[model samples]
Structure formats: structure tokens, C-alpha cells
Target: MTTTEHTPAPDAGIQTATGSHRKRLMVVLAIYATIIAAQIVGSLVTNSLALAAEAMHMAVDASGILIALIATILATRAASAKRSYGLMRAEIVAVLINCLLLFTLGGFILFEAVDRWFNPSDVAGGGVIVFAVVGLAGAATSLVILSRGAKESLNVKAAFLEVMSDGIGAAAIIVSGILNVTLGWNRGDALAAAAIGVIILPRAFLLLKQAINLIMQGVPAGIDLEEVRESIVDTEGVDEVHSLHVWGLTSGVSVMSAHIVPSAAATDAGEHPRILDELTMIMRERFGIEHCTFQFEEASHLGHEGLMHRDLAGLTSAPSVSGGQHVGHSH
Candidate 1:
């Protein structure tokens, strides 16, 4: 006989986890709008490459904030029969698009910086400093507003990183401005622009990798599949585990499912629920897995499955007790 059961996730908790930072994201967007305008005019007037790059940085960040806000709203929607997970993945999708935008802007900035380095030009350093300071102050305020939410949501985290990079770019522009005014080093502006570009590319790539992993249903960060398997096998009544899968539905939520073989004694004694309870407690307390599904069966079940579906199971004999089959992309 086989039994399957699940520990369900709370609806309210999922909503709270995904959508608690909408207002903060809106505030950040407002700040970006004001800063972008100031920096754009400052760049044109001062003819400073560093100031222009910072303006482009702020513009992209402003756009990302808007997308993040929309995603945050979408993630709060209730689940439906057709879409069981609701729109929780919206934030992740938003992140993927934002990463693309960041990469494009970062690449352009780098190209410009390189060209400017070869042909250094005059820059009005005193005027550029005024705009850089204004941008820096705006970046600082946005950072404070989004800091709390960054830890809670990936959407907010993306916005937070953008603002943080803008802040750094602004500081770089200030240094370049000082050098141009006091030391007549026009190359400093090019150097600062290059630094800002270098900063942006790595962060964009990292965020893109994370979003792709989530979309592919790869195991969430900090979760070790081997550790989880070992813990379950160490349970008193569980003889073995097979077909185990763990992945994230979105941030702060992890789901796991596995087939378990129970000891003959435990099966005969009708202690299936007890074994499940212990495993569930371990998963929740230790692994932060809120949704779990477990199937209890006899050891012969794997052999039986192999006999019925040899092509799929790829097993010519009884499966090993030490481990289960872990399927991955064929390519």
C-alpha cells in the first residue's frame, strides 16, 4: 500500500512574504525620478563623462523600481484553480528583465568610458560636483527607504542594488570632479566612468544567474540536497528515500516532495503518521521547508515500478538503499 500526504502553506503568510514592500518601492521610484533629471542636466552642462554615466545609471534604476513595484502588486494576487501558485513568480520574472536592462546600460557605459579615456576633454568640475552631490543625497535617502525591504523580497533587493550602485557612481563622479578642478586631470573623469561600469556588470550577471536558477527550479540557496536526504534516512522508521525534489516557488518559500520506504515493523504497526510528523518537524524547523509531500511505501515498490516502466526508471534490478536516482537535464 502507498500513502501520500502534504503539509500545506498558509495563504496569508505567502502574501505577506511576497508583497510587504510595495509602498517602499514607490517611494524609491519617486526619488529616482528627481535625481535622474538633475544628473542629466548636470552632465550636459559640465561635459563630464562621469556625471553622464551616473545619470544613465539612475535612469535604469528608476525604470527597475517601477517594474519591481508592479511585480510586488502582482505577487499579492490570490491563487486560482488554473494558477495554483498565483503570481508569486512575477517578482522573479521582473528581476530577469531588470538584469537585461542593467547589462545593456553597463556595456554602453564601459564603451563610452574607454573612448573618453583616449580623448580626454574639458569638464566643469565645480558645477559637476554640485549635481553629483545632489544625486548622492537622493541615493542615500532611497537606500534608507529600501533597506528594510531588501532582506524580505528579491524584487526590493534588485532595486536596492541599483540605488546602491548609483550612490557609488555619484561618489566616483565627485572624486573625478575634484581632480579636474584642482589637478587638471581630465582623465580622472574617464577613469571614474570606467569604474562605475565595472561595478554594474558583475551585479547584473549575478542577479541574472539567480533569476535563471529560480525559473529552472534549481534548489534554493543554502539548501543542501545531500543533507536533507541524510536527515530523512536517519529517521527511525524510514528505510530509504527516493525521487526527492526540493525547489522554491518564490522567495522565502520552499517546497519538497519525496517517496519514502518505511520499515516493515513500522508499517505493520500502522505508525506511518508518526514518521511523517517527525520528518515534517525536522524539515520545517531545520530546513525552512514550509510545504512538504511524502509518500510511504514498501521497499519492493521501486522494484515493482522498474518492472512496470523499465524505460523511465532505468533500473534493471532493485534500486540501491544508499541513494535514489537524481534526474537532471539531458544536455
Candidate 2:
């Protein structure tokens, strides 16, 4: 695999994104601490399953927050020989881990809900309500912090979405507590827990899928391969483009590489620089790709009429070596 460096946007300013992320992380840590304390107290006093479940969920939230904080710190580190990418993808990995944690918690809750269905347990309604209200406040704080930073970075955005989803879960628990208190509906508690799990499931899956795709070097979601090819081909000194690939190292940071055939009329050495400039601009403006590599070659030097022919006959064809055929090309 090849690596390409990015030139930060001029208007992006200096370290503003990192500063905003740090602020959000501080807020999240405070909120998580408060909620965990409240939930632990509520769980002890009421001995309610709902309160205990919320406490456990809060623990997961705390862990996720810590992970995000660490990721942010690592991401800001200057590049070194040991890790040249500067730990930018650490945030993406953190998001993936958070999603996995949520899914695991959801599964555990679902299993408990299934068992409770057969053998229901009594829950303290008043305590459940009180703690849930407190939890909602924490969730709301998290939402505000996350929303503020979501536009700044993809990792931060992912963390924000996770917190937002947790907030929704808190809201559901609150409603369940209310129903249990007023109507004496014990099953309402389990139902609410299950509902929380349900809400988290889709978001977890979505985040996990995105993280995996990034890890696999799949094309960034917003870029269209066909559109990229078309744009390159339309460039003034380019006859055609092929074997183009685009992917993200992390969100908002995309890299691309392609093979280009220089137009027949543009053979002068002076024209290569102009071609490169046009190709780079096209990639940035049309495809939101800032990092790119173009391998330029004259069409005649390609030793075939087109990319398809070169792939099928010129490159892949068997060649006599000694007295036998060499069947494949080695890098």
C-alpha cells in the first residue's frame, strides 16, 4: 500500500479541532462521573434491577468516554518513525471498540430481559424514577458536548452519536420508570431496558460497518469511482485513467491513486507538470480527495491499445523463461 500526506485546509486554522475535542472530552468525563455516582447510589437504595442496569450502562459510557479521550490525545501526537500516520486512525479504532461494547451490553440486557419475562422481579419505582431523571441530565449534557464537536472530526462525531444514542436509552428508562411507578407495571421496566437495547442496535451496527470498511481500505462512502474516472479522463492532457482507487485513512482524510495515459499531443516534458496540477485540482474539487498519486505514461508506451488489452494479454500473458513459461508477474 502507498501512503499520501494531506495539506490541511487554510481556513481550518491552527489546532481548533483538537481544542474543541479536548473541551468535549472534559465535559464528557465530568458527566460520566456524576451519572455513575448517582446510579450507584440509586441502585443501592432501591435494589431495583432497572437502576442496576442503568448503572452498568453508565459504566460502559464511562469506558467509552475514556477511550475517546485517549484516542484524542494520541491523535494529536506529532508523527514519529515508529508510527508515521500520527495515530489519526486511533479515533476510528476507538469508535469501533465503542460500538462493539454497546452491542455486547445490548446482548447481555436482551438475555436478562428474556429470563425476566419468565420470572419477573419486583423493582423499586421511586428510586428508578429518581436515578433515571439524573441519568437523563447526564445524557443531555453529553448530547450538547457531542453536537458541538461533531462537525469538527469524524471520530468525535462518532463518539457524539454514541452518547446521543445512550441519551435516548436514558430517556426510555425514564419513561419506563414513570409507567412502573404510576400503573404498578413491573414488566414495563424490562420492556424499557429492551427498548434501550433495540435503539442502540442499529447505531452500533452502522458505526461498526463504517469502521470495518475504513479498515479494509474500501472506498470512502461519499466518493464515486465512476465519477472520479470520468473527471480524470476529462482532464486536458489525459487520454484515459484506470486502476483508480480511493479510500480513507480516517474520516475527512481520503487518498487516491490511479494510472493515467498522457494525451498523444501533450508529449513535451513541460506538459507533465500542468497535467499533474489539473489532475490534483480535479481530485480535490470534484471528489473531495486531497491526497493522490498519478502514474503518467504515454499511450504508445503502454504496449497495448487500452487498459483491458494490457491487463488481458500484455501483463498477464505467459512468457518463456529458460525452457518453461513464466505464468505470473512478481512484484
Candidate 3:
């Protein structure tokens, strides 16, 4: 069955949080953009692989914040009939793209680091030190700006964590440069780059997994399917539930739909409305699910051949029964 849904406006319940995110993200974006340009030139001048890799990472961060900023602005748009949910998912999409890109970049940096370990390159220590310090300052400032709203939503958290890691990465580059200057250890640059990759790969993979799950309409984190089903089954009037579905639309939003068979006694007593209220209240309080839809039906509807969503519809309807035997594939 096509699930019935009621979508709130794009900015519904999020304006205050995302409003602050917009201003902070723009400031952070500008800082990262400037750092990318400066660090790229510095990396070329010093021929430091670590510095170069950090610059590329910062470039990706800049792009992430840029996308985040756009998403924040789009999130403010009013919900229209054509775009009922508005563009709140824009933030989710932006974070998804950023994570995939980060994963790819981590692989590239690791490969280069290993190659450099075999055949070392000349790294100008003094130049690397100066640039790394400058980058660290910028990354630190940006981190402070983003950290304030890091817990507000997924988008804000991604931006905050990215900048925080970059700040550490910048410090590593500085350490590598010092080792290169004092001991002629060019290998430190490659080691530093590899370390950066190690830092990035795990975080990137975690974020990628989360984004793909959301895109595939999986259940939200921290929600248990069995528990939800039990709550509904325990309700006074509901005898059975089928076609139950739960999924997250984006951050801070959960949706659910189900088909329920009412108890014969409850039907005779006209307690359907009370049962619905109890079920709804349980879902809201126990599971924190505010949006739900349920279809109430009699047990006799179970074998209705033309019923949608009960099974796939085609020239042949679902196998009902045969003689005294059940005629269907056993799951």
C-alpha cells in the first residue's frame, strides 16, 4: 500500500537550531576556503606530502561546509504542495556526499604515503612548519565556531568533527616538519600523512554507513522493531498487526505505519477509539515516535483477494488455500 503521510514544513521545529547553524557554518566555510588556498600554495613550496594531503583534506572540509550552508538555507523554505516535506533532507544528502568523498580521499592519501615511504621526497622543513601552524590556527578557530551547535543535528555534528580532526592533523604536520628539520627524517612526512588517513578512514566509513541506511529507509538508530511491535500487540483492542513499517525521514523525524486487526470483543464494545489513543500514546512516550498511521480492519479481511499491500497483485492473486492444506511458500 502507498503509505499515507503528513509532512510538516521544511523549517518545522528546526528554525531556531538551523538558524544558528547557518551563521556559524558560513563563517567556518569562509575560514576553510581561505585556509585551502593558502595551504595549497604552502604545500607546493615546501614539497611536504603531509602538508599537501592536509590541504586536500581541508579542501574537502571547505566543500562540506559549503554544502552544509546551502542545505541550511534550503531548510528554511516553506513546505509547498509540490514539495511537501520541503528540503530538510538536503542536509542529509550533503553529509552523505561529504562522507563518500572523505573515504575516497583517505584511500588516495594512504597510497601516496606508502609510495613516499619507499621513495622519499625532499621536504622544506621551515616552510612546512610555518604553513602548518597557520593552518592549525585557522582550523582551531573554525572548530570553536562549529562546536557550539555540534549536538544540534547530524549536519552540524559532521562539520564540527571534521574541523576538530583537521586541527589535530595540522599539528601532526607541524611535528613531521620538525622531525624532518632536526634529523633529516623525510620519512616523518609520509608517516604523518598515513596517520591522517588512519584518522579519516574510520570516521568516514561510520558516517557513510549512517547516510546509506537513512537513504534506504532503514529504521532509525536506537529504535527496536520487536519492542515497537509488542507495544502495539499489547494494546487492549488490537488483536494482530501486519505490514508494520518504521523509518527515519531525516534527523529528528520518525515515521511509522501499520495494519491492525481489531479484537471481536473490543469491536462489540465500541472501544476502537480508546485503543487507538492508547497505542498512539505508547508509541509517542515509549518510542519517541510522534508521527504514525494505522488502518483498522476486521479479522475477516485477512483473505480478501483484492486487498492491496497484503501481497503482490497481478493476474494471479495470492494463493489462499487448497483443500485442508495451506497453499503458500513457507517462510
Candidate 4:
């Protein structure tokens, strides 16, 4: 006999968080739009590479928030036969695209800065400073709008970080502008652009790593697989555990499934239900794993199914059964 536990998709909570925070996101997006436009014009007027790079960065920030908004809508759709997890992974996919865009934008700015270093360009320092201050004001406003939601939502947290970083980038441009105005250092503009590019690269790489890990169904960062296995084995009625697997559906949601053979005493006394309760409670209270599935099998049943000694690969233990069955992958 096989037992399975089915729960609602893990993104249910995210859907609620997104709904409440949607208005704040739209407000920030509008602020970024105005800043990007002002910076672009400032770049053209001042002939400043740093101003141009900042405009591009602000544009990227706006696009990321927009994508996140769209993803929130898609994620709310109900699950269909073709999509078991609904569109919960849409958020991850959007993040992946944003990371790639950031990489391209950062690389382009870096290349421009290098070229400008060789053939210096004249910059209007006072004009660059004016635009940088505008960018800073916008960043500060967006940060205020996103502060509340940042604690509850990953999307909001990401947008908050982007805005915060761009604010620092604006400060860098301001310093460069001041250097140009006071000391006639045309190279400072290029140096500031290069600094912004360098700052973007590490953040893009880290986000890219996280998105790819989620897509590949790798274990989430905070979970210890060995500890989970050990906890299961330590349950009172569990004789042995096998076919155990744990993975995330998205950023904050985790799911697990396992097979366990009940001890002889538990089976004889028909205490399977009690054992299930204990195991489920352990998963929920200790591991924070609310979604779980467990199959309770007898020792002879395992031998019959040719699942004698196999466990989730690399786990330290094997299933106990009376008959001699091979140890390896089960068909």
C-alpha cells in the first residue's frame, strides 16, 4: 500500500503578499521612469559617461519591477493538468532574465568606460551633478515606498536593494561631477561609470546563481539533507527510510517525500496512523516542511518490490527487508 499527502501549491502566501504590495511597486516604477528620462537628457547635455550609465541602470531597475509585477499576476493563476505547480516559478524566471539584462548592461558600460579612458571626453560637471541629485531623490522615494513590503516579500526586497544600490551609484556620479567641476578631471566621469559597472556585476552573478539553482531543482540553501534523513529515521515506528527527496517549489516553499518501513511491533499493533502523525508533526514543527508525503511499507513489501537496500543516493542507511534484494537504483 502507498500513502501520499497532497497540499496546495507553496506560492499561495506569495500571492497575498504581492497583492498588498502591488501599488507600492507601481509607484516605484513611475519614479524610476522619470529618473531615467531625466538622466538620459542630462547625459546628452553634459556629455557625461557616468550620467549615461546611471540612466541605463535606472532603466534596468524599472524593467525589473515591471517584470516582477507581471510575474505576480501569472503566479496567481490556478494549477492546470499541464502545470502541476501552476505558475509559481514565474518569479524565478523573471529574476533570471533580469540578471542577464543586468550583466549585459554592466558589461556595455564597462566597455564604454575603458574606451573613454583612452580618448577622454569633456563633461559638463555642473550639469552631471544636477542629474545625479535628481537620481538620488528618486531612489530615496522608492526606498521609502518599498520599505514595508521588503520584510515580507522577496520581490519587494530585490527592488529595494536595486534602488538602494542605484542611489549609491548616483552618489558616485555626483563625486565625479564635482571632481570635473573643481579640478577639470575629465577622466573621473569614466572612472565613475566603471565603478557602477563593477558594482552591478557581483550582484547580477549572485542572483543568476540563485535563479539557476531553483530552476535545476537543487536543494534550497538553508536545508540540511542529512539532518532531515536522520530525523526521519529517529521516529519511533520507522524501521528504515528510503526514496527520500526534498526540494523547493520556489524561493520560500519546500516539499518533501519519503518511504519508510514501519517497525515490526508497530505493524503488529496497527499503529501506522499514530506513527504518521508523529512524523508529520516532526516535519512541520522542526524542519518547517509543511508539505510532505510518506509511504508506509512493510518489510516483506519492500523485498517484493525489489527495493531492498536502496536509499536516496548518498544517504548513510539502507532499507531493512527479509529477502535478499540488490542495492542500486530501483526501477
For candidate 1, lDDT tens digit of each residue in 118-153?
A: 999999999988999999999999999989888866
Model 2 TM-score is 0.81
- Predict model 1's lDDT versus the native: 0.82
Alpha carbon RMSD to native, model 4: 4.1
lDDT of 4 at 249: 73
Task: Show the colliding residue pairs in model 2.
Answer: none
lDDT tens digits by residue: candidate 4, 145-264: 999987655567678878988998999999999999999999999999998898888878877887787788887767887788888888887777767788877666677888777888
TM values, all candidates: 0.85, 0.81, 0.77, 0.84
Model 3 score (lDDT): 0.78
> Model 2, stretches more than 4 Å misplaced?
1-6, 11-20, 151-154, 300-331
Which residue runs does candidate 1 get wrong by more than 4 Å? Answer: 1-11, 16-18, 306-331
Q: How much is the lDDT of residue 309 in candidate 3?
A: 50
Residue-wise C-alpha lDDT for candidate 3, range 2-81, written one tens digit per residue: 22333333445545244567888888888988888888999899998998899999888788878878877887787789
lDDT of each: 0.82, 0.71, 0.78, 0.81
Report the candidate with higher lDDT, 1 versus 2. 1
Best-performing candidate as measured by lDDT: 1
Q: Best candidate per TM-score, number?
A: 1
